[model samples]
Target chain A: MATTLTREQQRQNTPDRPKPGGRPGAVGGHRNWLAGVAGWLWLVVVVVPIYWIVITSFKEQSSYYITNPFAPPAEPTLGNYGMVIEAGFIGYFVNSLIVTLGAVIPAVLVAFMASYAIVRSRTGWFLRSVNSLFLMGLAIPLQATIIPVYLIIIRLHLYDSLLGMILPSIAFAIPLSVLVLSNFIRDVPKELFESMRMDGATEWATLWRLAFPLTRPAVVTVAIYNALTIWNGFLLPLILTQSPEKRTLPLALWAFQGQYSVNVPAILASVVLTTLPILVLYAIGRRQLLSGLTAGFGK
Target chain B: MSPTATPTTARGSRNGGLAWLAVPALVFFVAFGVVPLVGVLALSFTTWDGIGDINVTGLTSWQAVLSDPGLPHALWVTFLVMALSWAVQTPASLLLGVFLANSQRYRAVLAVVYFVPLLLSSAAIAITYKALLDPNFGLGAGLGIDLLVQDWLGVPELAFGVVIFVVSWQFIPFHSLIYQAGVRQIPKSMYEAAELDGAGRVRQFFSITLPQLKYTVITSSTLMVVGSLTFFDLIFVLTEGGPGDTTRVLALDMYKRGFQANLMGPASVIAVILVLVGLVLALILRRLGGRDATHSQMEGA
Candidate 1:
């Protein structure tokens, strides 16, 4: 499958002009072959582990041990997935869903409003300071602040609850969200905003009716970006929550390791089930996720 | 509507009204980010368990962190990972980026293939690799390769190397994506002109691509440094800094002190040092990048 794709790509990649036969031409040809080989090598290195996980997820415990690990399962079964689901995988999934949505929605919405204000209120020292504040937040690693965060959560009586995770996650996410959203908002034409003002629209009205719609791409970008981060978060849940029931997917996966030790197939089956939602999300929003991640660095 | 009745008034009122719109975000940032950060810094100077009354002991925790026996080893391991990641991941990604950029067809599919590991959770990647590298029934033994079967995670010498390889695998795609974006920004005319001048692929890459990617390389390097220093979840899950603490990094050290040992003060000290290292590295890289940009600009002139 991969070879056919590469062959078609090579056909399309043929240059318009014929090459001059010389030392440089020979070297160029050698480099192209090297590139092709490296490309295929990288494809294999990436695909094999993912392929292993999916295939292993389908094998029963006995077959997983008996069959060739690299081969397709001879007795493919849904038993591993059923065991995972029976072990409360759905509960963890719902917990992850609630926390992710609870955090990302408020973070993005607040960031959009804040970003709009930052870009539009050009002359205010307060807004300028706020922008700088967010930039400074980029340097503060969350690991460094976990100690105080735990204490604060305990003080607020929110420790061991999803709200504890959601609040701090939202807080940490705001800085980057505002940074990206503000950059996107600044690209909107000044005339569009001015015209909206000329039509006697209040600033709030213009924000919803004009700026919101125009910056939809940035909104989606920040939304998916934060959702991915919060969804896969481990440290927050590990530190903040203790109950077996409150465990998010990543923490649940960790817990499963100890409980099902030596049960490789069942453990891997849980791993596959836990990651399926995020993989689906990535497939849907990959372009935005990629562009958003690299967007800040590009500047 | 009148033809813009005093544009300044409209602008002034709008600005004033909207300036307050940032208040909610500001509150969150200050309460969660700013306060906690400041709290951690202050707490580093004191001895306080989560339950006990705080006692300020000036410079004690700092002194302990500086002299702690385990810290130096953890720092060494972290530095090893950082150096290895830069040595291995960066150039590989750059080459992959160059190849992908030149490949016209199947670009989207190929990129998605490369990015799959990155999209999955760190815990998931760690578990997947753990199973794949399992000494008994893993892919190694299953494939019947004699040399492939080994206790990868159990051996102290090999455990750190395995962790580094996994970390590199997960992040290489990200660096490649960045380089791909950088490669796309290079104007095609330059490459075409080089080809016209009989410059081979190697020379063109050295003269055109490398020079154009200087800023990107620096930015990515800084990110790699900071990321390696603070990386926790994957390493924690994979080894828990196990097999005689061979793979322990600074973050894990902090986790142990704060949570397991209940040494909050010392943990705070490690946290402070980690943040300082990140900030100093970022500033240095920025300064270096700034100088290079100006130098190149002068040469261009």
Candidate 2:
């Protein structure tokens, strides 16, 4: 049955050519089975820690102590989740949402216009300078900038506020975001822009209506990437926000760590809480996730 | 100017004016990005601790960065960690990707499992792993893998291993997807032909699949090289450059000197070197990896 399908697939793949490899009947069945098992084994190893976290999230502290760590809980409970929630997980969750979405929206929008201008504008020198700056940004690690960023925040009186975090996040996000979006926009059909201009659309309208809509994949890709970057970010929020009221998820998680050393279940529980939204987002957009990453970053 | 020429020139100038609209981004970039980068660079020259005023002395920070006992060892350890992690992750991702591409039944499920690590903040992952790797109540003891359960974050070798594992685990699925994309682009007939040739799966993978995956390999490796160099958050959260700075990469060290020590100058120098490495890696990858390297310019959303 497999040999028959292989022959049929070959005929479709290369209609004119003969088979490239050797005989058809006796294949490497044993080796194929081994490879298949090897592949599954690889996946199992990769998935174990993640599975450990999820299962541990449900297990009670006593159960976590007595039972084998690898075993499922004897009886799982929402008690850990309750502890995490009561510890004000939702406030931090909201702070994260505010920071992530707040950064993403402007980052995407401003980057769209900037990318449109950078790609379409006729002037060469300005475009070159802008491009190079963004490119250089690919290397500008946040650790290097944390002090100066801290200074700027206090100087501007934006310190410890969402705006302080949001603004810089947008700034840092631009180089990569503009790079991706502009490349994508550059792929947009020239005729589309010409037609829109002929219809008397303003430059802004042409960008928003014709170019931006077409670049949805790239835009959504940028949004998701920025959201994750902002959400998962530690140092910026750590340095910038001192007030517990304003702290993001990462900061809050750190607070949880210092406060809850022995509460293993609650810590894992918070990890579950903090990690869930993005994981769900990943699940919904997993297909696009890889493409976005490889398309933007991979050679 | 002719009327049409004048209007066109006027529009061009306006576009030029609008181009500076990137200034909001530029201002922040210069302030948050460029200013600090330059500030760090300038700071690296001085002998100042991170606190008070920087005492500007040329090459002092550079001298410290180069001659400091920890600095060179840190660099070596970094390269070792990155190399070993790449060794582990690149092949792992490629094989997993190939398997997922072939099987459809649990692809999404498996992908979610793999990608969950990417979602958590590095601090959170560090925290969770700390709990798991705990010497006492931690699962490491409970599982009887006592040998595997050293003070993973405190000892130099074990700390290095833990850091590498954490970083690699988070990004491996990402690398896998890159491989999967490359695999999908390969025409189906190649696999069938190899099968017909009595090529076993392992043989076929080498002869067919691996060769075709050159672009993905180059891209992912380049990313890994640059990424591992500046990796800070995990190291920062997990070890805080501790068990006596055993896990300090360039970025982590830079953070320690510049921010923690308030020796802005030395930190800046470290930052410059780190950025320089990033640029050099990017340029090298661009040259060696073909036109696809330019595709990264398109990466932002």
Whole-model lDDT values for every prediction: 0.80, 0.73
Best candidate per TM-score, number?
A: 1
TM-score of model 1 (CA atoms): 0.91
The alpha-carbon deviation from the true structure for residue A102 of candidate 1, after best TM-score superposition, in angstroms, is 0.6
Over B101-155, each residue of candidate 2 has an lDDT whose tens digit, in order, gives: 5433354466656655666678888888888888876777779786867787778
Which 10-residue window of candidate 1 chain B scores lowest in summed lDDT?
Answer: B292-301
The deviation in Å at residue A126 for candidate 1 is 0.9
lDDT of 1 by residue, B197-292 (tens): 988767888888888888778767777877888679999989998878888888998898989888999999988887887788667766888753
Steric clashes per prediction: 0, 17
TM-score of each: 0.91, 0.87
Chain B TM-score of predicted candidate 2 relative to the true chain B: 0.85
In Å, residue B275's CA in model 1 sits off its true spot by 0.6
Q: Candidate 2: global Cα-lDDT?
A: 0.73
Candidate of highest lDDT = 1
Give a tens-digit lDDT track for model 2, residues A1-299. 46854554343333222323432311222123443564667577667777788888899887788788888888989999998889888999999999988988988887787788788776657766877887778755555566666666877889889999998898888888887887788889898877766675666666778888898988887787787788999878877887888988888888887798887888888888888887777778775765555546532
